[model samples]
Target: MSITPRAAEPVDIDKYGPYGRPPSKPPAEARKQTRPGPAFPNRIGTSEYPAEPGRYHLYAGHPCPFSQRVMIVRALKGLEEVLSVSILDPMRDSRGWALREGEGHGLDEVNGFAFLSEAYRASGFEGHYSTPVFWDRTANRIASNDFQHLDTDVATAFDAWATREIDLYPENLRGEIDELNEFLYEKVHNGPYKCGFAPTQEFYDTEVRSLFAALDELDARLADRRYLFGDRITLSDIRLWVTLVRFDAVYVTHFKANLRRIADYPNLWPYARDLYQIDAFRDTTNFDHIKRHYFGTHTWINPSRIVPVGPDLDWEAPHGRETK
Candidate 1:
């Protein structure tokens, strides 16, 4: 059930760059523009993209929280064998996320691609080329980059081939999961970016306050339950944990989301550590890549491009969350 490949279209790099705004445009006008990710939104297990082992590959970067969500699900669902992944170098330039040969980053094993943009061109897509890209090796195109539901697809689609029996998106919990996903997406997952890229003081003030308020609310919510949905780790936990893991490391200083550190949160801090103790979450996280990408790459935000040295997070310190 393969679809026709599209012709490559011209890309407007500036629109998809760090801030999603062209240089000539005033920062205030950024809100008016929409630089949603590339439009190859097909899902796995569909008629076009069937659920088959070794047919899909993931193109991801450890630094990106969105990409991390997909990687975490892939690991938790035991799709490492069914779906292969390539880790792009964290540092992105004008050309976009690349696969530099000798730099220890993953080579484009599936398509012999140099830059991720090539995948978009090969898929006949045009726009911001972001990860985690779900490549359809069988069709020689990107199966999906719809970050919103990509993790859910990976969580459910390849169940027959999954090495474990984990179900991150259980049928009865999907309604609750969807509601939490929307709330977290608006206030937590994408909050730091809104605050960091805000054009006006008033805008930053509003966004930053809302961001912290949401964090405070989440802290209170987790005070009793072991997870967002109780005993088991669901997609909601993955969504929130990715943000929490990077909050103190990058978001606090880099994004000016410095009202309080996640370390200071009584419940959320330990909960993040609890997830980190799990191999899937711990293995996919790359602190070096995360720090360097935020401080070194976003030169527009930090002109000096100086990567910071000391937040001294003790991720391995005993969380003692097992009883909860």
Candidate 2:
């Protein structure tokens, strides 16, 4: 029993944006304090980016819930021919995370590199050109953008080319799944970007009342669990189902996070439609690149970008939660 260290909470480097909120800007090169290549060998087949089966690639951004939590742990550890992904072009501006050729995105076909800041300057990673970006393609560059440990390193570093080995960071629940994945990344996955990039109005009413008091205490602790550490599915339910599948399609009206809706959470809108009826969280959800990447890339919070259609969400209705 040895644990005592707590007193450091005062970071306000202009209150968010270096890879945090409001269309994350401020890093066009020259910020690197290390990140050039080869650091992320977090075990498995070991050393210098080992775990091979097509030697790593992921870039990801179906509207970035931290690249949909490592693309739902690389599609729940099937590891899609052992860790390969692309899917960028979710409408980011300030010239970042591009690739081109739409329809679930294209280009950057393993470092053809149209953008993504040229795969972070082709290895010499300057800084916040963030995405899922794990890329090593035979040591040509980045091993990780550290999407908070790339969903536990693609759910435990390619477990011998995981064709659905499905552990999702277990080992006796890894200290309560790293304390509910840091309280679901600080009160429910970056708590709607700290109430849509709050820098005023009493800090957006104290972060939208601590983000609906941590989503009303996880909708009463999932009103008797079916997931979030219960019957299966872990990594804290894929980091709270990629922010409840983009909280009413892009944080209820482009990150205004309109007070109440994850369909008004009666147990988190049927636990986010019972993890969107599974297929690795409904085929790694797109929602038109999560509603044109937060209403057309946060033009200082929607300057006539207009990508809304209606609430109109269904997520294929019935989420009975398998008789929880």
RMSD of 1: 4.9
lDDT of candidate 1 at residue 204, scale 0 to 100: 79
Q: Candidate 2, 279: how far from true, in Å?
A: 27
Q: Which stretches of candidate 2 lie over 4 Å from their true place?
A: 1-48, 51-63, 68-94, 97-116, 120-130, 135-140, 143-154, 158-233, 248-251, 254-260, 269-293, 296-324
Model 1 has an lDDT value of 0.83
Consecutive 10-residue window with the lowest summed lDDT within model 2: 27-36
lDDT of each: 0.83, 0.72
Q: Which residue segments of model 1 deviate by more than 4 Å?
A: 1-35, 102-104
Cα error of candidate 2 at position 75, Å? 20
Model 1 per-residue lDDT tens digits across residues 1-324: 433323222222344555233344354554433246548877778998888999888989888888999999989988899888888877766677877543335576667777888999998877788888999888888899888888988899889988888989999999999999999988898788877777778877988998999999999999999999899999999999999999999999888999999999999999999999999999989888898878867778886768999789899999988888
**TM-score of structure candidate 1:** 0.90
List pairs with backbone clashes in candidate 2.
none
